[model samples]
Target: LESILANLSAGVLVFDRRFVLRTVNEGALTILADDFSGLLGEAPENWPRQLALGEAIRGAFAEHESSEWQEQIELEHTDGLPQILLLRGTQLPAGSHGGYVVVFDDVTRLIAAQRSAAWGEVARRLAHEIKNPLTPIQLSAERLQMKLADRVSGSDAEMLSRSTQTIIRQVEAMKRMVNDFSDYARLPAPELTAVDLNALISEVLGLYETSRATIALKLAAKLPPVCGDATQLRQIIHNLLRNAEDAQESVDSPSIEIRTRLADNLAEMIVTDHGPGFPPEIMARVLEPYVTTKARGTGLGLAIVKKIVDEHQGRIRINNRQPAGGGVVSIALPLASLPTRGHRVSQLPTEA
Candidate 1:
């Protein structure tokens, strides 16, 4: 049992009465980029990973009388692989030989999630507080220009009017940028209706039908109604379809296929295209606001898609298409048990 537990994939350490290393698990050794035999007797200074682990063990020893010692700690190993360890255990009963058991867990992913969530909150605040004020400023500028036009006449007045108009125009542009950021920040609780998923797809498809890219809607026959915000949901689709259309720009035969299907409990919308695919490294951060790949791109399209999907309690995943068409984006939205939308998806005119 001792060997079995030690061999498990958890960084573990046992310390004797003096807090000296008595045993280290295979997991702990692996994290240190070494085997247990090599690390059994070495002090922390000799191993970077074990230094953090060793400190955690000591902290556990000091609080031995407590019910449990649990802390999430970060460690950097000589091998360059950073590992997160969860130090957790209780003190052995007072005996001739006292010791402690500690467990190390890799929480790198959890920490990343926490960081993403924190930064997302900061972005939201910046958008709302900073972006919200620009709209009023723009309106005020517009009103001031109107007054200036009426109050005076001449080249000087014309200059003032032009200046005011420029201010208004720039402010209006900034407002749109702010709106994009605000969209990235503020989340709307979806008012899910029994939306004909196919109908919504068609409406968005028809809206973009004028684009040079050949867009097709492959709706699942007898598709179930989806629960989502009709307007924002359309925004999500529009953004994706537009992205696909943009991707298809350099393709020999530009084409985008909006395919829907059931994958377990979620409704999947896959937008596949034929163009140069997304760069692998940028792919992960592609959904983040303002992370565009174009020569002059705002990069908010996918970010807005991500935000809306999140509001609708859906997932948006991106991947390259099979057999090399281009990129394939999958949006899996939770199937609503009860009606989550108050609006419905109505087909729009293809010409619009």
Candidate 2:
């Protein structure tokens, strides 16, 4: 019984009729981050802040009736993001001392997956509905400008020309927006191949070396390769760099730094910029689709980067840099072993 309970995937805890914690499995310890031994004789009344759990157990023992309940609990740690747990409680059968058993599992990833799937479906429908009419509208406006420019005179023609130009420009902008939607909605599966992240970052940085922002690099010399789609990874890098550039546009000493290192069996890349940090109101939901603070953005840049990172089985975190006025974006990808010889790799990024 002890061996089986220790190996169980779901956390389990049992309370006596007196509401004292009688037993707990290893899963409980892992899930709740509590020492099971210490909780053996502890009463639920003293279980700080566990209002729902205490209420369910007390009701079951008081009414002598089996009860079932479910609730979400947040687990915060010092190293990573807070986890969300789905907890279920059930009243056990009557005995000399009746008790209730609780089982819980971490459902954070499940919720995120559902959200991602929903967004992908929405993106698909939006791109299909919005993109089809843009080209025709643009073409019509251009044709009108060419055919009617001389037909009108004075301010009429000037207004006509301006109107056509605005239509053309707006249509082009809409086309870009639709393209971004398509990219996020139809993100292809990453073609796994051994990729040197440092080299990849260097190649991406080469494209923006001429920009105003001072781009700096601090790549780990002995970093391991990561198995991922190079094309998608490049796009991720492009999005972050562009975001940093946009942020630094208004700063006096605009600067951006790209750094890489290995931590906890993962290859990590961090992008930091000297600019105003993310607004407090939107920082938590910055990755959600259609959430943006920029005037010209579709708000899907970070969302798409998140999608690609998720596809690569990686993690990303966005937070304000400490000591204060800049933003940091960090991503960690599982390191991959070098591929064997004769292994076929995919085409160049352009083809992808």
Q: Best candidate per lDDT, number? A: 2
TM-score of candidate 2 relative to the true fold: 0.74
Poorly placed runs, candidate 2 (over 4 Å): 36-45, 48-66, 73-80, 93-96, 135-169, 210-212, 222-224, 247-252, 274-285, 319-325, 334-352
lDDT of the candidates, in the order given: 0.71, 0.81
- Identify the runs in model 1 with alpha carbons over 4 angstroms from their true place: 1-116, 131-162, 322-325, 337-352
lDDT of 1: 0.71
* Residue pairs with backbone atoms closer than 3 Å in model 2 (clashes): none
lDDT of 1 at 288: 68
Global Cα lDDT for candidate 2: 0.81
Residue 75 of model 1: what lDDT? Answer: 65
List the pairs of residues colliding in candidate 1. Answer: 86-105, 191-340, 191-341, 192-340, 192-341, 193-341
